[model samples]
Target: MADGSSGDSAPYLRVAARLRSRIADGIWTPGGRLPSRGELGAEFGVGENVVRRAQELLISTGLLEGRAGSGTYVRAPFERRPLLRTPSAAGLPYSGLAPFGFTGTWEADSTAKAEAPPLIAARLGVKAGDPCVRTSYEFLSARQPVMLTTSWEPMAVTGGSVVVLPEGGPLAGHGVVARMAHLGITVARVVESPRPVHVDRDQAHLLGIATGSQATLIERTHYDTGGRPVETADILIPADRWDITYDIALPGT
Candidate 1:
């Protein structure tokens, strides 16, 4: 890679661009093993570390995959699925957890009597260290992990009830609206704020992606008819694999 013409671009990024071009030109087909880092380093006239970084950059972009003890290879082509957000037929706001037409299954673990942190407390309109039930979820499509969510519910609301533990008791897995409804509470609204973020190392490992990969974080909260926040959750979606879309119902429809 020539550094003379390009201004201020990192060497690894330049190498990554050249590698990307080669992949686009079919120099390396999908699932085709790439040359060793040392060989690529020699070919690119850069250090092996630089080549490694370049390969990592490509991997983070979903253009390449690295196998343990094996070499890196071009990733197979995959279509981006749309994650639909729409209101339910009953006129309630959508949870935005499961996408429209998604046939996936989810696994969740709920911990009872957990103390809410400051941010979570603020989101739930409760004081820090308030007792809450925390549930962590991993949603999979076709047996592959596609989303992650962590939800917190105030114990003051569900305490002494069958829905105290989200994943336990009679209302297990029924969702916040239904569980609250069982307690004679009406869920009137759901508020979601989505933001783009880079996946951290732990999240990357769970999602089978590279650290620093682009993803979306949705801060979702459920409110009762009286405007009290009942539950709040943070949902993580891989940006490279899915596009988020909203379907709004017109008035009087």
Candidate 2:
């Protein structure tokens, strides 16, 4: 927020607006740490308390997070796992949520890699060589590979934590949401879109299915409070072992 830039509102509110714009415009991003109050005050020529107030306002609005001893940072958006257990929801939400009725792990192995594909590149808003988490998960279905998923996270936000991928690991216990939360990054929503696609020879080989067999492609993107894209995943599921179910009430039924 600029000093004496405008009038008629509380100083903190104006600061909040400016911070919001920076985040919306991608100046700040999920898992990105914000400047210290002293730094902000120096930049805007405002008092330290004024900057602190502004930060408090944004935190209350869910755009920023205040971490003890770590300074403030932009919070990760929420990733809505409707299928995962919520205290009040009845029945499991989706087939993918549980693999053979057992809780499993989502591991991050492999080194962080840069994205070169045009579509992924565009979604991540990064250049070809930008660093990202090269993560893969093998979901167990009665102790077999029910689904294979790969995810990519911006390295700037992950802070080198995305490289740990052993089974029964820290991430395995809490899933990605809890891991992000420990890092002060929250997932505000998760949007999943799944569609049927013909399995190619390569996919069939990994999934133990025949070429041209039917499969479902699941794509999910998670966003943060400030609406920055944090993580994205693509999963391939074999049709034979999985069932897609949803409930709807008919007027005359």
Kindly give the number of clashing pairs for every candidate. Answer: 0, 12
Candidate 2 off by > 4 Å: 1-100, 103-108, 161-169, 246-253
What TM-score goes with each of the models? Answer: 0.73, 0.53
Collision count of model 1? 0
lDDT of 1 by residue, 50-84 (tens): 99888888888888866544678788775678888
* Winner by TM-score: 1
Candidate 1 stretches greater than 4 Å from native: 1-55, 65-74, 89-93
Measure candidate 1: CA RMSD. Answer: 5.3
